[model samples]
Target: METHRIEELERKIQEYETIISEMSAPIIPSIVPQTILIPITGLIRAERFDKIRGNVLNFIHNKDIETAIIDLTDISGERIEDVCLEEIGRELHELASSISLMGVKALFVGMNPELVKRMVLDGIKLESQSFSTFQAALKYLMKQKGLEFRKISE
Candidate 1:
């Protein structure tokens, strides 16, 4: 009787161990699609360029996002110093070139008065690279990919 009880207990323990092992098995993580939207804020300083670069790389690596919108709505309206404007233009040009090289599309939205003035003074012809608003930029970007824009009520 004692021997039988020992065997039964061992068997039960083994069964429980098996059940726990099965429950503890590693689970495969699910992949979810992510969208890329970056908003530029405040003064256009050199440090901000790093944020933009990091954000771009992060989207490319983590989200696999091909479309990005840089909104400059929060930027203050003031005359940009020539040196600062030059730096800003250089950064913009670099970002545009980088996105184009990576086969990604980038649209700069929110053309504030200060930005317009700086662009005019610097003779920076953004052409299709910049847009007046996020909605228009989105439409233009979608159009470039042969996609139709759907109107959403604000």
Candidate 2:
């Protein structure tokens, strides 16, 4: 009947939304061994934070990841206020703590300076090692592994 079709469509839409949400937070393994990078974009709501935490935990639990780089470069400071920034900072701190407990070093990269200042002004302390860019984090990891990169000319 019409009602049954509508219900099926609704269920499908919900399923798609869930899939999209999960895809938004991808845990990508870096070229360096035992390093995983998670690039976060868009507005990070409370629900999204939970999803991010769960996904990162689940993925790292199965992999031999010694370092996790959480990149927040794509998020703009103009889009979020100080209050929201504080909340997101707190969530990031929690995520970092959890990852540390699992024996993984969590490095936060690409944080907005303004937001970071605001968080600091609010007395929010971030325990994770932070870098201004993903490249910096990668370089640090490579150094830790005693690996060097040479530019190859085409």
Candidate 3:
């Protein structure tokens, strides 16, 4: 049955494509327990937001992710005309609010400079604890949790 082999190959290809699609939006585990980092990068399309939100919410729902730090440092602005940064800002605020309602603290880090400038001019500000970098956010969380980094062996 050559047809059976062809069907199996098609199924495998579909699975691989789905995996690649999910991998496009990654969620990383942090050094601290109950914390995770989600770095938003590249041109985030409107349709992709639903998938992103679904994945993030699903992951958080499944695990004890107390704090979620979203890093936007790598978010590209090359396709500035294609999407509205203000809309994205609103979405980010909504996401943070939703995470908070779930008993999780959602922080932001490293917002793109261009985005910041645009949002400032547009009077769109995200109401979340934002830091300059991912490390800064991590340190802030660690301090809030009564933890600190120490060199036990150097």
Per-candidate TM-scores read 0.58, 0.91, 0.82
Q: Which stretches of candidate 1 lie over 4 Å from their true place?
A: 1-35, 78-83, 125-128, 142-154
Over 6-90, each residue of candidate 1 has an lDDT whose tens digit, in order, gives 9999999989955643333211111212235566654455654655675566447644566667676666545232347656766
- Indicate which candidate wins on TM-score: 2
Q: Residue 147 of model 1: what lDDT? A: 73
lDDT of 1 at 112: 75
1 or 3, greater by TM-score: 3
* Better-scoring candidate (lDDT), 2 or 3: 2
lDDT of 3 by residue, 1-154 (tens): 9999999999999899668658766899999889999887656777666777778888888678899998888775774435788877777877887778778888999887777887788787666789999989888889889998888996
Q: Ten-residue segment with the worst summed lDDT in candidate 3?
A: 74-83
Using lDDT as the measure, which candidate wins? Answer: 2
lDDT of 2 by residue, 1-154 (tens): 9999999999999999888888778889899899999998765667788889999999989678999999988877654534377787788889999999899999999988877887898788878899999999999999999999889999
Candidate 3's C-alpha runs over 4 A off are 1-17, 79-81
Could you tell me the lDDT of residue 48 within candidate 1?
48
Model 2: how far residue 116 lies from native, Å: 0.3
Worst 10 residues of 2 by lDDT: 75-84
Residue 143, candidate 2: Cα error in Å is 0.5
